[model samples]
Target: MLAETARPTAAPPTPPRLGFLRGWDTAIIAAVLVSILVASLTVEGFASPRNTGFLLIDMIPILLLALPMTLIILTGEIDLSVASIAGFISCLFGALWSSGLPLETIIPLCLLLGAVSGAVNGFLVSVVGLPSLAVTIGTLALYRGLAFVVLGDQAVTSFPRAITTALQAKIGATGIPVWIIPVLLLALVFGVVLHFTGFGRSLFAIGYSEDAARFAGITVARTKFWLFVASGAIAALVGIWWTLRYGSARGDNATGLELSVIAAVLLGGVSIFGGKGNLPGVIAGVALLAILRNALQLASVPEDTLSMLTGGLLIAAVVAPNAIVWGRTLRRKPHTT
Candidate 1:
C-alpha cells in the first residue's frame, strides 16, 4: 500500500494591516499642529484669513514643485536643475511674449522647451549612465546659462492684469486663493499614484535595488527619464504662474528656489537616499516651512535667521535616516552571552 500521507493544510495568510503614519511623519504632523497654534497665538494677524490666503498663495509654486521632487527623491535620484528650468522657462516666456507670440502658443512652446530641457538631463543620467547628481548639476548650469542668453538682463513685467486677477482670485469669504486647489488636487493624484499603483511600487523597488528591480522587469531608465521630464514640465508651469502672479518674468526669477523645495522634501521625511515617505508627510513639511516663514516675516525676523533654519532642516533630513539605520543595526547584532 502506498504510504497514505496526509498533506498538512497551509497556514492561513496573515491579513494585511493598513498603515499611513510611519517614520518622521508622526513627528511632522505634531510639529505642524504646534506651529499653527503658536503662530496664531504669538504672531498678531497670523490667524487672519487674508494673511493666510497670501501665505498659501506664495507657497503654491513650492507646493507644486515638491510633488515631483518627492517622486524623484524616492527613486534615489536628484534633479537640481528644477530651479534653473523654471528660470529658463520664465526667460523663454518673456522673450516669446515680448516678440508678440500669442499667449497660447507661448505657453505651449515654453512647456515644450521645458520638456526638451528635462529630456537632455534624463538622457545624460539614464542613457549615458552618468550619476544623477553630476548630470543635473551640469544641466543646472547649462539651463541657467541658456536662460541668461535668452533674456539678457531684461525683465518682462507687463503681463495682462486679468491673468493675475484670475490666478490670485480669492476663494469667496474664506480668503484662501484659488491656486491651492491645483496644489491639493495634484497632491491627491501623487498620493494615489505613489501609494496605490504598480508604477509607484516599481519606483520603490528601483530605489531599493535597481538590478533586482530590472530583473523584475521594471523599466528603471524609462521611469527615471519620465520623472525628470515631469519635474521640468511642472517647474516650467510654475515659472509662468509666478510670472503672472507677480507680473514679472526675468531670467533670474525663482533663483535658488530649488533649495526650498529640496529642504521641504527632506523635512517631509522622504529618505534622501530614497525608497520612503508619503505625500501627507511632504505636505506637512511644506506647511511647516510656510508657517515658519510667515510667522517670522510677521514678527520682523531677519531673512538670515530663516536661511539658518533651512540649512538646519536640510542637515537633519540627511542625518536622521542614517541614524535610524545605524540604531537598527546595533539592535540586530547578537550580544555575546
Candidate 2:
C-alpha cells in the first residue's frame, strides 16, 4: 500500500472576540442605566413624567450640536467655535426679527450666516493649512464678540406665542416634547450616514492617516470644509430651537455650551485623538450628563458645583480611555525568557 501522505492539519479558527462587550460605548450605556436607577431611587419625583419631559427637553440642544460635532472629531479635527456660532446666529435671529423680517425669511438667513461662519473656519483650517484647534478657537472669540455687537446685552423675548408653544408642546401624556420626534429623525439620518455610508468610512480613514486617505482618493480638504459647514448649519438649527424653547434670544445664548457638547462627545467614547465613536453612545452620553445634572439640581446642588463636576468628568473621560489602552498594550507585550 502506498504510504498515505499526511494532510497538514488546518489551524483552528480563532474565536471571535467579544469586542462589543468590551467597547467603551457599552460601558457608557451601562453607566447611563445605573445612573438612572440610582437617581430615580434616591431623588424624590425624579421618575415623574413632568420631570422626564423637562430632562429630555433640556437634552435637545446638546444632542443636536453633539451630532455634527461627532463627525468633525472623527476626522481628527475639532470645532471650538460651535457654541459661539449658535450664540451668534441666535443674536442675529433676534436682530432680524426686531427689524421686522418674516420668521420664515429670518430662519433661512440665520442658517446661511451659520454656513458662512463655518466656511470661514473651514477655509482657514482646510485651505490655509492652519490647525483646526487654533482656527476654531479664534473664530470662537470672534463670533462671540460679534454676537454682543449684534444684540448687545438686550434679550428679545417677543417671539410668537403659537410658535413657542408648538416648540414646547408634548406628545399626549408622555411628557416628552413634540420636538424630540424631529430631533430623533435627524439623529437617525446622522446614524445612517455615519455607520452605513462610504463618506463615513472615508472620515475614519482620514482620521487614521490623512496622507493614506488622500492617496486612496478622498478629498480631504473639501470633506473637512463641508464637515464644518454642516456643523455650523446644525448649530444654527440648535440656536433656533433654543431661542424658541426658552422664549428668549440673547447675545449670550448657549454661552459655554461647548463644554457640555465636547464633554458629552468624549464621554460617549469618541477619542479626542479621533477616528472612533458611534451615535448611540453619544446619545447615551448626553442622557447621562443631563440626568446627572437634573438629579443633582433636584438634590440642591449649586451651579458652581455642577460646573466643577462637569470639568472633572471631562478630564476623566479623556484620561480613562488612554489609560485603558495603555494597560492593554502592556498586557499584550511578549514576555522575556
Candidate 3:
C-alpha cells in the first residue's frame, strides 16, 4: 500500500495594518493646518493677534462641549439636549443671581441642575431602554422650553467685572485666552482616559456591539448614564463660561450650539453611526470649523451662508466616510470575482 500525499493547511489571513499618518485623524489634522495657512494668506485680519484671541475665546464653548460629546458618540449614542442644557443652566444662573445668591453658590447649583437634567435623559434612554435619539430629541425641546420658563426673554448683564475680565484675559504676548490652559488640560485628561483606559476600550466595544459587550460583563446602562451626566455637567460649565465671557446670562445663551458641536464631531472624522473616532481628530475638527467660521466672517460672509455651510459639512461628514468604504468594497468585489 502507498502512503497518501499530505495537503498543507492554509495560513490565517493577517489583518491590515494602518500606516502612520494614513488615518482619518491624520487627514483632519493636516486639513486644519492647511486651512490656517490658507486663511492667513487670503483672509484679511484672520491672523491678527486681536482676531486670533477672539477666535480662541469663541472656540471655548464648542471645545469644552465636544470633549464629552466625543465619548457619548463613541458609545453609539447622541445627545441633542446638550446645547439646551447649557442654555437652561445659563438661565438658571441668572435667576439665582437675581434672587441674591452669591456667584459661588449659584454656579454649583446650576451645575447640579444640569446634572439632574441629564439624568432625566439618562433614565429614559438607558434605564427605560428608549432610543437615545428620540430621548435626547424630546429633552432638547423640554430643556429649551424650561429655559424660557426660568428667565423669560430678559438677559442678565450684571456679573462681576473681575471674573468676566479674567475669563477673557489673554496670556502675555501670545494672544491666547487664559482660560485655554484649563480647557487644554481637561482635553488631555479626556484623551488619556479614552485612549489608554479599560473603560475607554469598553466604550468602543459597546459601540461596536452592545450585546457582546454586555456578555463580556460591561455595565452598559451604568456607563451610558454616567456619560449623559458628564455631558450635562460639561454643558453647564460651558454655560457658565459663556455667560461670563460675554458678561451676560440669558435663556438664549448657546441656543443652536448643539448643531455646531455635532457638526464638529462628525467633521473631525468621528462616525455619526459611532464606534470609531479619536480625540485628536475631534479637536482638529473643532479648530477647522472655528478657523473657517472666523475667516469667513472676516471675508464678509453672511451669517445665513455660514449656517448653510455648516449644515452642508455635517451632511458630508456622515456621507463621505460610508461612501468611501462602499466604493472600496465595490472595487475589491470585482477583483475577487
What lDDT score belongs to each candidate, Candidate 1 first? 0.83, 0.86, 0.84
Clashing pairs in 1: none
Q: Which ten residues in a row have the lowest lDDT in candidate 2?
A: 1-10
For each candidate, give its TM-score against the true structure.
Answer: 0.92, 0.93, 0.93
Q: By TM-score, how accurate is candidate 3? A: 0.93
- For candidate 3, write residues 67-133 as lDDT tens digits: 9999889788989999999999998888888899998798899899888988888888789988888
Order of candidates by lDDT, top first? 2, 3, 1
> Each candidate: RMSD to true structure?
8.1, 9.0, 8.0
TM-score of the candidate numbered 1? Answer: 0.92
Q: Model 1 lDDT vs. the true structure?
A: 0.83
The candidate that wins on lDDT is: 2
lDDT of 2: 0.86
Measured with C-alpha atoms, the lDDT of residue 41 in candidate 3 is: 98
Query: Per-residue lDDT tens digits of candidate 2, residues 34-141?
Result: 999999999998998899899999999999999998889878898999999999999899888989999989999999999999999889889998888888989999
- For model 2 the TM-score comes to 0.93
Clash pairs, candidate 3, are none
State which candidate, 2 or 3, has the greater lDDT: 2
Q: Which parts of model 1 are misplaced by more than 4 Å?
A: 1-19
| Deviation in Å, model 1, residue 112 alpha carbon | 1.2
